[model samples]
Target: MTTSPESSGGATQSHKPACPTAEMGRWPASWEQEMQSTVNYLWHTDDLLGQGATASVYKARNKKSGELVAVKVFNTASYLRPREVQVREFEVLRKLNHQNIIKLFAVEEMGGSRQKVLVMEYCASGSLMSVLEGPENAFGLPEDEFLVVLRCVVAGMNHLRENGIVHRDIKPGNIMRLVGEEGQSIYKLTDFGAARELDDDEKFVSVYGTEEYLHPDMYERAVLRKPQQKAFGVAVDLWSIGVTLYHAATGSLPFVPFGGPRRNKEIMYRITTEKPAGAIAGTQRLENGPLEWSYTLPVTCQLSMGLQSQLVPILANILEVEQAKCWGFDQFFAETSDILQRVVVHVFSLPQAVVHHVYIHAHNTIAIFLEAVYKQTNVAPQHQEYLFEGHLCVLEPSLSAQHIAHTTASSPLTLFSMVSETPKGLAFRDPALDIPKFVPKVDLQADYNTAKGVLGAGYQALRLAQALLAGQELMLRGLHWFVFSNMAGVTEIQELKRAAELRSKLRTLAEVLSRCSRNITETKMTLSNLSSELMKNRDQVHEDRSIQQIQCCLDKMYLIYKQFKKSRMRPGLGYNEEQIHKLDKVNFSHLAKRLLQVFQEERVQKYQASLVTHGKRMRVVHETRNHLRLVGCSVAACNTEAQGAQESLSKILDWLSHQLLQDRTKGAQASPPPTAPYPSPALKDLVLHMQELCKEMKVLASDLQDNNRVIEGLSRVPSAPDI
Candidate 1:
């Protein structure tokens, strides 16, 4: 169903990678003749996949399943290769079965020639080398894509290790990317032409690999051809892996001497072999330039510093030429796997102005992370306050990294020093409470006839009230200043006077409200009595009318009773007296009902005219009583607040006076006050409480004013007697 680029001969050309194991070229002359001789159709070649010096791979379709597969057709030159080398590639492919290893379908022969061709899986995305050749990846792959490359390569190599196979050639070209079922990129190892079975300690003398990715010893033997006697082990594959990773990460070889890797072989050898202890991995120099060596990853690397830290050590271990120093496959696999297992968490310390990006396991505890922060920022463990995602992170010893939803450079874990100064809270306190002693006292008794006198009283009262509230805040601020500072200063005397002045004003207000509440209560009682008298008068009239009606009904009923008795005695004498008596009783009952209905109608008509006036009087009385209760409560609260403020100020004044006397007696001189602008934790808490209290007081004061207005309104309402 998929097609490649079409050519003039009706055949298409598959994607050719930058460093493909095979290249594109014309097929052998007898290939066409051999294919046409078969009577039964097998597969038809639609495009040239790749061709090399020995063999050409073609994009072929199976006639039976209509599936596309890669067919490797060995030519005359490839036939000269050892029979065992040819057989090994097929045997290795057939034996491996992993998601990261390319799958092999079957082997088939040409029609009449009996020449064999290998059928393999077709990769649509081409080789990893093709991806590196992309313009966007010129500076190396992006971090997320690079992680994918690392994971895939490690998986494929791990599979090879498990199968006891040394790839010999482990580079980008040999890794192919296929589009998986879920649209994910899956990188698979392909073209294991140089692969052979080797164990951890086993040694092999034959050399095979791409030059740039080959080990130093292998390079010395294969390219330099001046090797004495050094057998290659499985560690050679790790060297090639390091080179491949470096290329995938930086988009260039780690070591480039003089002209280039290929042009100056002697220099490349010198650069790798002449290092003091081991091979210097990121060493490069331009033509006729000084050498540039980097022990760490360059700043231009796309990977984060946290990732680079983990990856560099692994590279250093693998890139060493000394066999004794190079890490074994087990150690190498573990280090690379560790990088994939953990996540990068960045922490920013507010006081220290430092950022620490560390690779932490998801299961590591918060205590462990805090220790790391202490190491980086030099802040003590007890002083650190960690916040994540704008919320305080509780320093529970068992809280793990996985509990955090996410952390990155843009939204890192913010750390605050608990002992650090809080300037904002202190600044707020200064404007309200820090009054100078030289300021003139308010003249409250001054005449208010003048405009200036009237404004000054109000302004002074406002300032005094604000200062009182600020003085209250010192209860919490005392935690800091009280512990270490002198108490008997001029500022303390002013604060004492301010508290006394505010308390006196509150007491006077309380007395005024108490008097107002009493007047309203008396007025309400008078109205209630008048309402009771009016109700009593109306009920007396109703009772008199009911008594008179009842008298008339009794008289009528007595007459009917006599008639019935006479009828029972003289049943034979004249006119049916029993029936007559019954009829008269029914008529009397109807008449009594009509008379009561008339009384009820008269009562309703009598009160209808006065309903609105009486209702207004009663409502006024009800509202006045409710306001009186509220005013009574407000008076009590105001008195309590005044008393508490007076006692607190008195206690503070006495303590400071005592301290002053003691200081004079001991001949101890006062030191200047501390100049720190920062507020203590207690001060910050006091500020918040003071703000909320001020808002509540404002609302209460407004309610008290409304209650006063309602009391005044009650006086204008018509008296119950007048209504």
Candidate 2:
């Protein structure tokens, strides 16, 4: 035998044999030896285990500990840049620390080739897709066991959502089960290759995911009719969960039929536009029917029939074709929790279990429900008393009068007795003028006008002032509205002022309340900081033997606690005992008072502004009308002059309009047209213009009358406004 030059490290090195065996006969003796040498080289160098288009993975043992590790080696020369992958993978893995998630251990580079390797926690059980499709498939797991597996998946996904991460690609291939005891398994989610982190105010984008698990919005592109669409965040993960659960429960994907990739798109369309024929039918076949999908599946799997039913209605609310109907995270969380609770109860049938689930889920849903309730209940705190008290007053102001009469007829605060042994006053006859007996007729128009006038500008101003005073009341109310409305909490006073004309006054109220909320928030933050500082200085405090120093600290603590209590107290307008009791039943008085005060302050400021700016113009119109009448001008002639004058006055108004436009424009060069400066046409000018127009027509009429044919022609001329 002759040695091949490439063979090394004490391995067999043969070039050729005198008589070749069948295995060696097909190739040249030297080539066969080289092939063996290449295999030995790979075994020794640990450079390759599996190879792909851009990269290869190797099974390697740590040189120091001899522990087995999977190293993903990437070709830097290829399209997949190693640095980019390293950065993205690191960023993603650092934020995600779920048990179900694969852990990234370390990254290293080979010195000679500049080749990179990423070491990751290896799963011995392998990918979910392989297990499900292979000999050790979990497709036939017992119903209880299946549900347990499903729950693990859901818990992992829920953990992801809690941390604001979305595993966009949720499929069997990405999930791995870690075997525990007696074939029991805990599912681990792997492959963050397609994961995306949700921003504080972002919705889901990219519409990218596995075809089987794609949501209707992702594949079919139907207008997302759910409120969640507005800010499609973690809910996309939920949709994927639905697909996963459907597959787990039915042993087949709900949307995709028994066909290849070509049919997948069509199946998605059907799923989005048409309902699954019997998505829930098999659910009843389980040993325990219709498992609680919410708690069981991964964030992606919980999207089963039960969830769809609950979510569709909610999505309709959130993705309401009308944006207003769309629900925000708060609304979505609330509806989700409610449905989850109902489903849990429906499946488990045990109150204790249901309560436990409820408690576990409460943290997820409470703030949202509280916000919804707050939004629904938010009213002007000042007007709260008025709302309840005024209703009573409207119905019966005579209660106060009755008390006064009773007091006068007997001792103070006591009612008069009918059978008293007192002599009759004078002749005990009814007087001719029985003033108290007269009844006033109800005047509907007057009453409405009075109510409107009373609630005008002044009411708005009062409300604004009250909002400033009771900070927490405004903050809580605003928070409620923000949750319900999904608008940014107010940052400015102008936003509240502008809210006056919109149909939803809640938005405006929320804005004002938000402004005041800062005070309460800052106070709490200060208290927390102080307490933390004190705790840090615990040794110093103890070391101080001076009683005065300890007393000072105690005083500070007491003051903070008192402030906290005061901030937490619900503010309300004080009503009489009877009024308070009556209002308490309706729960309207507190809100009414707050609302009234806000409206009153706004109204007063507006009314004052209008008086200062527009009053003179109104007076001019009145004076003009009077002057036209005094001049004996016909209504038509006066009206024409008034119209001409009003139009001509635009020249004078231009300056004011330009100034206003400049104010609005800020740094911009262009100016808007002036309209405010041209006062409205006086009534006198209108009348005068009308008279002049009438005179011109009369002269033409007379000329036509003298000529019969001309008169007929003149009659045909269209009539103009009297001027």
Candidate 3:
């Protein structure tokens, strides 16, 4: 219905991408069926996203993982009538899995509803067109940032082309970006609603593209025909890409604003017959062709000539009046990729033969190249300063990219280095360069000791020349200590020897352990048994036992033990043993009785006192158990309260269910007045079925039947059958 700085260029012969033969109505393999159920349950109310003539979108989150998603809902009555729903985007995006393309997660049909829903990946950052023109972005993007947007756009467009899909609308609104977990911004192509699949046939004609970004052929040839049989190919998308880039790079559209009666005619005239009216000032690149639109490039007064040269050509191809040689992302890449790759630079150092053909990536920063120089020249990074044509290297700018477009191969760039006069600097200097004269002292013993002390870590910081020159003459005529170590080999040997010695010690220890192991197992088992018995007895004995009970138990124990002792001192042993017994003046039975009486009275009184403490502890435990039971009851009450809260979604879902069940078979086709519950039709059917089962449950109780011949809670429907 509206224009988007609409446009296209001339046609070029290339292989048209083939349409995937798969049908579009089904969900892609990436969708999880189980998630579909959760999605329906948790997505109670949808956050309205936007509305358009064809469909409305809403934001919803997965209840389980809380992952955000977008759902596109088709109009119910209109959907069921003529067009049903175009699931083209589902089919297209299902087949697509590119980082720059919006992902389609699932396809959903609500119960008895004519509307279909498409669940898609969510992009929090809205449309690029909005950001550029809306209040959020007070000013347009900077050139460097705009270039990033361009790269992502081209990548997305190229993906579409390769897949044999044309995103008929290539304006900024169609492009949106998502910020990743690592704070990386990724732009994605959305609203495949306007996209159409391409076949092997070279000519493709559609009148559905937005007016703002209409290709020239669509207006001049297609609009001119009787039925508007506009014939074009993927080149149409390329032209729109140009217009988008122009709008993105420059803060405004190229075509002049038009209104009143013949708006389309005025816009078409400006697109075909005339050049762009720069809302924002721009410089023209006149190298490509006489067509001013092709030469319509960004104002690059502050930009590098190389960048301009690379960009101007591609812009020329994209906006070319003739579709022939139209630049898609392929031509764009070919033009820009070269300057980003290998760069040729001449190196000039004072007092050394200058070298030509120094090759490095143009995209590399001066910092990175300097590091490489550090490796080769032995000059530290901090000490190295590079000069590019007398200017300090900055911006670490991309080299082989469009920057080289304006540059000629004949005027090769020269890189000059001014290294500080340190030891590392001397290493980078030509060996023939003069040095201050001094005697080189050689102390092999001291050097070897130092190397041994620190090289246990297996690192050596010695120059190759110094290592060899330590014992030999004719080395550097200077005095400087170069750290050298033999620990690399010594360290390896020490590790191996130590590992072997440990292994031998372990073997010897094992042999000694085996010799000492014979009685240990038996002793340990005996000790373990004794300890278990002692613990069991101690746990059973209550310090709270009554003193009288304890005394009775002790008396019984004494009687049993006394009889055993009496049996050992039997009368048969009187003659020989009686004399010895008499010699054992102590009365064993008497002594045991005296000791029991003395300790029992004192210890039993103390033990009985401890019983009062235990009784109090038992009372506390009993109270805690009672309190825990109450907490359990409280949790059950909370569950009932939560159930009450669940009624919130009931009214919403009930209304949705009513609309969904409405027979649209004979109704007038119009936009459905309201939306259904966010769940899929399958889930709704499940909930309804479960409800029906709940009503029929009283059949399990025979006595609960009603006198009216109805099964108590299983109240029959009034004239309708339960489904």
Candidate 4:
């Protein structure tokens, strides 16, 4: 049946009425009144929807519901058609309830003529054939539109196969398109007039399908009227689906012999039956010209290669003339299901017309899609904001690519590559360095407060570490002066040699402190940028998992603070030697007096005053610890490294007190020096201990540098969205 170009339901329409009128052969004039009175359905006689060989469809309205429906009225000749065929269509439609299949409303009878009419759900967008006939779609349907058609048809056919039925006629004309409430295009299979119960492996002798889409075996006996023994199985529908898919993809039949498929049926059948393996299509321009063959879709096709790679294999397997070679409905359904589960998204970065076609599974989240987009455009994931149908595409685990594709597949998703602003106190260098600027902000205020507390504690620990580093350097400088400036108050030859050895030891310790200081400076610079980066992008963490991660980081920071406090060296830069004196056989009276005189000297007193200033400076730095703002796991790492530096400083102070300084508080005056050679057994033991501390400090500096490298690596980690 044919219907209005603007309004197509069960059938299509044209200028003249497709049904039998008074001029041809009309039913009674009162039949319309009888139909309205008996069935409560008013048929618009002027609005002919479509006309087929035995029926005419019209636009009709139900009086009780006031809902528009398509009315398929069988002509007088249809009454003489097979009773089994008529009953089968009604039964099939009544049992079917799928979104991809046309819906049947009611079967009403006309009182005057006693004629039956089918009322089905009306589709305003008409048939797919009409859409493909449009000038813009002359080449083929657009890729998205083609995918919709392909998926819907496969779903409808799969539903039929599940119910042990086969739609002998599958074509674009038998499929209808409707605009959904959300403006999404939906395709539904209609006109199941040729459908019948036929399971796999079951055979039927009848041949009933459009010639262009018919299998060669069916074409031979049906069109040529040739004697044939082979019966058609359920696989016949696969042949029709292949033709429909090819037509929707390229706007032409896959096999067209010379003079077109309609005029040269014998040649078209030969072309389809004689195709070699892997051959996909055949074309001929003239009756006598050589036929051209193609193994894949032409370059003019709009579909992406990713889609064609999956779709073409299904076409090749099902287009086979031999039923044994053709795929079963299960394989066909599985292949189509895979295709439906994957979507090709066209992403266009704003201000540039170039489009990136990204392929992703329908189940993937927006975050995953953004990562793929970043790979294509080199835009940082955190700097990308995508808009689909004018709504921001945010990270939500429940929302997936399928949902977006369902709602807004007509237009490319617009990607706005946001330029991140520079964080305060940090100058921008390379754009690539700003990749991980987006850090998840703590959701709970209590957690945030706890984070700040940990940062304050860490800042205090770093200050203590710095103070210890300063003291260690001061002690090294003081020891250097004492060892080389003839202030040791020793006269023995062995004592002079021991002093030279001590001077060399002091130089080595000084070099270790220098390296440690460099490590501290570099770490501080790294933390400054890391803290600013985190503060600049305080995107809220909505997910419970992300919140837990933030809490875990805070807990680790508190642990590091505790460890730093526990490992802190005791204050005063001197140790109690009462235990050592009890064990020593020699008296230290002479050494103690010499140390006191040296400390009181003007040159040594200047170094002593500098030490007191450093102690006060540490106190002031600690007072301002709470004012410092540091965030992220990187700060926690800094605290850990500071703990190592403090240990190193403690070792340096221990060596200074053990090997060089005397306890001046033990003031027993003018006792004889040790009778044994200078730097007795205890002093030699202290020197060896100092050498070990130097080696440990080198390792500590190396570890601090390694930790700094770890923090730098964190800047490159992509910040995952809070889904």
Candidate 5:
């Protein structure tokens, strides 16, 4: 089954052609004739575009439609089982329908020798590899153009997932770009020749496709006679996308080994099992010399810390060694979408000047409000008394005013007991000084009945309660002010301008609360509904028949007055006031017992629910905090590296300046005449050094800018939430 190079075509026999060339290879006469006939059917012989390993692509006009198309004619003689491969690829292509995937028109068969031609949409820009390897190839593509290409690749992979297909052969060469009307480029995924249609029982048997682009799972799968139980699906496409992105960004493959024939195998093994080597890892110093240089590193280290923090979880999900822990596309997409949206909001909010001002103002207002509330409602009894000392007093009962006044001038013991034993004994003491001592002796009935004590004590309690309520109202107002500040400071100007909208929302909430409060009587009726609902379930606390019986007994006594009035006609049923009061006391006691039971049950349930929710939120906050820590650490590292670079660049500049000055001084000393014909060699060297220093300064400035961008990106990550 193995066809040697000589027998097939000996394509490499000639000085290797930049592209496939028929003149450089030898083919069987019959095979050549079959290819020629197929080409003629698809296109004019003069319009033969190019040739690949086993096919010749040609520009052809469809005879029926008169529309131009690209035809791929496969040489059956070169394929191991050409018919099967072609059918498989055709089946896969026909099922795929996406804007980014190339469209398949029709399949044409040559009558003799079983030659087949695939007709596809014509791509004027040809293949990405061809473009990249061309004479005018540039080092770096524009960011927009790169993103366009990336989007196409992702879109095509998404389509594959939709159709349950895997491309197996994804490479730059297989991708095509077409220029749009406005000079925009549109990329399309083509060549499904090596793709597989996955099924439950079936598994890929062979390790096929280009080595550089192969997934690690493929090699493992090939080593085993039976495929791994866990199949590599869409994640494999994601790996390819990662590699493609790295290539586009850096203009080279991420991992290229530096050794002999075994190097490729080593590199592949490392990719499958180990972390990437020689990644940038920020910056470091040598143990010995002043050696420093900026160079491309593995993406494992080269990726910005902010990006690394994002990628770790993604990689954990995508490249999970454990199948159980791995996230499917749906879960991955949902989590990623949430995180990305949060990150966008955070980044945009960071640089707004109003945000800081609002935050400080809100904090200050909250502190002041809390202090006022604490002072008002948290007053001790002693503090309250001290506040109303001279103005207020509790009413009490006792003797006549003259005796009371005399007793008030002395201490309590001497006042009450002494005055009762000898009423005139304390009369010499000043009345006002001992007033408190004598106040307790007066009968409360007489003292409170008088206008002064009633007005003073009652007024004090009312004023204290009013003040507490006012403090609470001020705290509520402060909340409204803080919310206003938040709305005003939003970085999105249009959103900030929607303060009126927020105020309207607040007004709506107020209206709703007002309506709910007004309908409290109706809402109270629902409390019975709640009780009934609770009673219906056997597991509920109120469900016991004994409890229901007790409730009925209590209900009868609850309406004792009504019952007593109605019982007038029925003499035996009527109860005396003493008996009625006794029933009332029993009813109150039963209600208290029921309330205690309900409160205990509710307390347990509330605690358990609170604990569960608290744990969940704590875990989320912990994860967010860790992510923020990583971001902060990365930013700090970037700043350190930048500082180091700046120092180095500064030292170099200072040295250059000093050397130039020294050279100028030497030149002036060597030249005796004030006006010399020409400057000395030292002076000329200084000029050259100055030019070199300027170039280095420009380079350093660019590096500094990149470092600043990285730092800015890191700073945008949110700080950890307070515990």
Candidate 6:
């Protein structure tokens, strides 16, 4: 039943022409004749636009609607079985509606000529191949443009596969974009002449398209003309995509071999033997170098293992001389999905920082962060206190990264922290006159001044805490080296050294604190007497006499208050009565001098702090004067004295409150067995006057309360409250 194939320009075999040419002004006979005869038909040919081997395309204007279109006129005379080719192309084009696939407008059979014409949406920017081969982009496609084209082409091919069609020919020449220069890379699949439908078995075997872009297995099957050769699915187009990508990036094909009379054989041999090669600028050899010889080193070494593995199935199949292994679209998409998944956050240790980059995941927790910190610095978990905005982090093992970020606001947050290990003792530990680390060699006042900063036993606990933290930072530099080297356990030994040093500082700090406690006790009793005497003076009812005596007492108390502020005693120069009572023993000898010096100050800070404290309290008393006037104390002189006395009282109360915060525990070691010095009579006399004044004020306040009640009774009914 098979008859002789119709003659195709005296050629019986199917052949690929070199890229079909388009001479701008040359109107071929077939197009010129069709335009002449179809003057009233839908589309009229304008000029020769582009010509492929089997079709000469023309930019045409629709006669009825004036719509511009591309009219692709098939050259039936140049192809055997042209009808079958036309039908397959028409069916495929009509079924596709994807944005990345060229749109078919209409199909027309020209009169008096055995020619079929396709009217398609005109693409002003001709083809992808032209853009890459153009002068400005001679190096290769730009990265962004390449990605756009790649994604668009894959989408188009996927669309075709979904409809059970296979585009056997996929190349830059067949991919084109519309007129806009902005989207020159928004390529669409065109010219489905070589395309065919997949049978119900979902497979296709065809010898079609340009040879260089062909999958080697497909080429081999076509060449051998074997009936039993395996049929491949839609992967042939994906192979073409890989080839297109390679050529676009490097401006050259990967599998070129020596050409001869046995050119086909040489190409096949090289395709099988040669590995793909190209360099992505600045790509370094990874710890594991490139893949084995069977696979090509890709142009980009930075691609994820997912994408790199995808390249194996993609290019590796194209490298096959026999059947090429490939993945379906679903598998391809699965590999590319994780391209954006992995993100990292860098953690650094404090002071001697060791930056360690770790993957940020929903499962990342503080415990994991602590482990990383421990590896960098030998600071133990107990010593690490991570804080942000004065609030300590709840370092729960189960708290996750996102959970922390929810509490904190954003990523890459750095927690400012420090190590605090030493415990400040509250009381004397021993009666021995020797501080653990102290020497009795001090003879000069200048030596004592030097002691104030670091050598002083009073600040030794603070110094030890500072030293331990500083040493921890220094020890971190060797922590990693020690772990991997013969010097292992060095960090532990250094930590032990810090612990021993702390014991000495603990004894000294305790001794200083104990002496401080005794000083506070003696100072408190003096203040109590001064308070009592001042109150008595205020209550005397002899206005000028009582006010003058109270002011005099206040001046002495003011001197002590100013001295504490000037010396920067955050907890002041006193301790709480309860805390002092809890101590086993107090060292009274050091209190007369060492304790007094604890509240002494440098000249400049002393002046500035005293002046500022005086000014601030003065303002507070000035505010009180307005209230004083409200209570019928309208006399200006009375206002000034009352305001001054109120300010002095406030200053003393502030000092007592600050002292409550100082550590005065009884574990202190006695630095020296020095005798307690009794208070000066001048200070005791000032205290006695204040105590007597307090008794007088209490009596006056009681009388005033009784007088107010009687006056209120005279003005109001018995049921009313006293004013």
**lDDT (C-alpha, whole model) for all candidates:** 0.56, 0.37, 0.43, 0.57, 0.41, 0.43
Candidate 6 local lDDT, residue 312: 46
Q: Candidate 5 — which residues are off by over 4 angstroms?
A: 1-41, 44-54, 63-66, 77-79, 82-84, 134-140, 199-203, 220-234, 259-263, 276-328, 331-723
TM-score of every candidate: 0.53, 0.33, 0.40, 0.52, 0.37, 0.41
Per-prediction RMSD in angstroms?
39.2, 33.9, 48.7, 31.1, 43.0, 34.1
Q: How well is each residue in 1-723 modelled by candidate 4, as lDDT tens digits?
A: 122122223544334432332334444675554333226666656666676666777777676565667877777877676899777778888888999998998888876877787888888777888777643354567677888898889888888988998888777787888889999878888877677898797999877777787878988987777898998899888998998999899766899987678788777877888887777788877886777778898654556555777788999999988888989999999888988887677765442223456777877887787777777666777766555544345545356666654423235665544442211111112211111111133123323233334333222222222322333332322222211211111111112122222324345334322332333333344434433332332221111132233334334554533433332333311234323322221122222223223323422333344444433333322222211212113333433644565577677667666554453223224353556324456766766776676575555445444534543332222222221
User: C-alpha displacement of 124 in model 3, angstroms?
Assistant: 0.7
Best by lDDT: 4
Q: What order do candidates take by lDDT, descending?
A: 4, 1, 6, 3, 5, 2
149-185: candidate 2 lDDT, tens digit per residue: 5666766776676777777667665666667778777
- Candidate 1 backbone collisions, by pair: 23-51
Off by over 4 Å in 4: 1-38, 63-66, 285-287, 342-676, 679-723
TM-score of 6: 0.41
lDDT of 1 by residue, 176-239 (tens): 7887899888888877767889888899998877778888898898888885698999999998
Error of 3 at 454 (Å): 67
User: Model 6: runs farther than 4 Å from truth?
Assistant: 1-47, 179-185, 199-201, 221-232, 258-265, 273-324, 336-723
Global lDDT of model 4: 0.57
Output candidate 5 Cα RMSD: 43.0
lDDT of 3 by residue, 407-476 (tens): 2222222222233221111112111111111112322333222222222111111111221222111011
Question: Candidate 5 at residue 80, lDDT?
Answer: 61
Encode model 6's per-residue lDDT on 49-142: one tens digit a residue. 5666676766665654555567777776535665676588889898899988988878886676747777787766667776655422433454
Which candidate would rank higher by TM-score, 1 or 5? 1
Q: After superposition, how far is residue 556 of candidate 3 from its true place, in Å?
A: 99
